[model samples]
Target: MAKKLIAESAAAPESFEQAMAELAQLVTQMEAGQLPLEASVAAYARGSELVRYCAAQLEKVESQVKVLEGDMLKPFAADGAGEGMQ
Candidate 1:
């Protein structure tokens, strides 16, 4: 298989969930070892891309949570500030 073809699979996916699922399916198919040489090669390539997409999605989620956590939380105000102080 051409390395360039495999490189395309390493690119990020548009939908994180679908990409992760596809990647997992690819892994299962590989484990089965029933695919032809060409199909196996293509799956390997696609799996790499899905992995990249999944990792990027996770990183984005973590960054967003961190940002929210770092902010000073405010009380609901309507709750009459019964909660703890900031």
Candidate 2:
């Protein structure tokens, strides 16, 4: 079952959300501790792939945002106009 899932995961995730969802599902199943050693290994491998995929997706978006913002990334301020905001 785990190997089958890993094989299925080989077909790249359609989107970041999909990858995250799959990764979460894998974590839940592995945490159950019911899988055999081989299955666990397979799940770990697939999880790693999902993590990489998500990271790459985030990097791509970050680069685009940086370009759009002309690299003027500002530190986020929480309390709305907290001193020197203007």
Candidate 3:
């Protein structure tokens, strides 16, 4: 069962949202503290892999955005204040 869980999660999804949803589910189940020790371990491992996958996806997008912006990446501000802001 653990192997199967790991195998299923090993396949990358077409979208980051899908991976995040699945990762959230795994986290919920693991946090519930109802799974056997082996299953918990498997879930944790899958979660770790999902995290790495998500990070890679984000990094790719960030790189693309930077290229589109001519590498002039600006810091994001929450108070409506930053570079290029009036």
Using lDDT as the measure, which candidate wins? Answer: 2
Q: State the TM-score for model 3.
A: 0.76
Q: Which 10 consecutive positions of candidate 1 have the poorest summed lDDT?
A: 1-10
Give lDDT tens digits, candidate 1, residues 1-86: 33444445555666887687667767887798877788788888678667776888888887887689784444457666655866
* Candidate 3 positional error at 58, Å: 0.4
10-69 per-residue lDDT for model 2 (tens digits): 788999999999999899989999888998988898899999999999999999989888
Candidate 2 lands at a TM-score of 0.82
Model with the higher TM-score, candidate 1 or 3:
3
> How far does residue 11 in candidate 3 sit from its true spot (Å)?
2.0
Residue pairs with colliding backbones in model 2 are none
Models 1 onward score TM values of 0.62, 0.82, 0.76
Q: Rate the local accuracy (lDDT) of all candidates.
A: 0.70, 0.88, 0.82
lDDT tens per residue, model 3, 53-72: 89999999999999998997
The clash count for each model shown is 1, 0, 0
Q: Cα miss at 81, model 2 (Å)?
A: 2.7
Give the Å error, residue 79, model 3: 13
CA-RMSD of model 2: 3.7
Candidate ordering by TM-score (highest first): 2, 3, 1
**Of models 1 and 2, which has the larger TM-score?**
2
**How far in Å is the alpha carbon of 57 misplaced in model 1?**
0.7
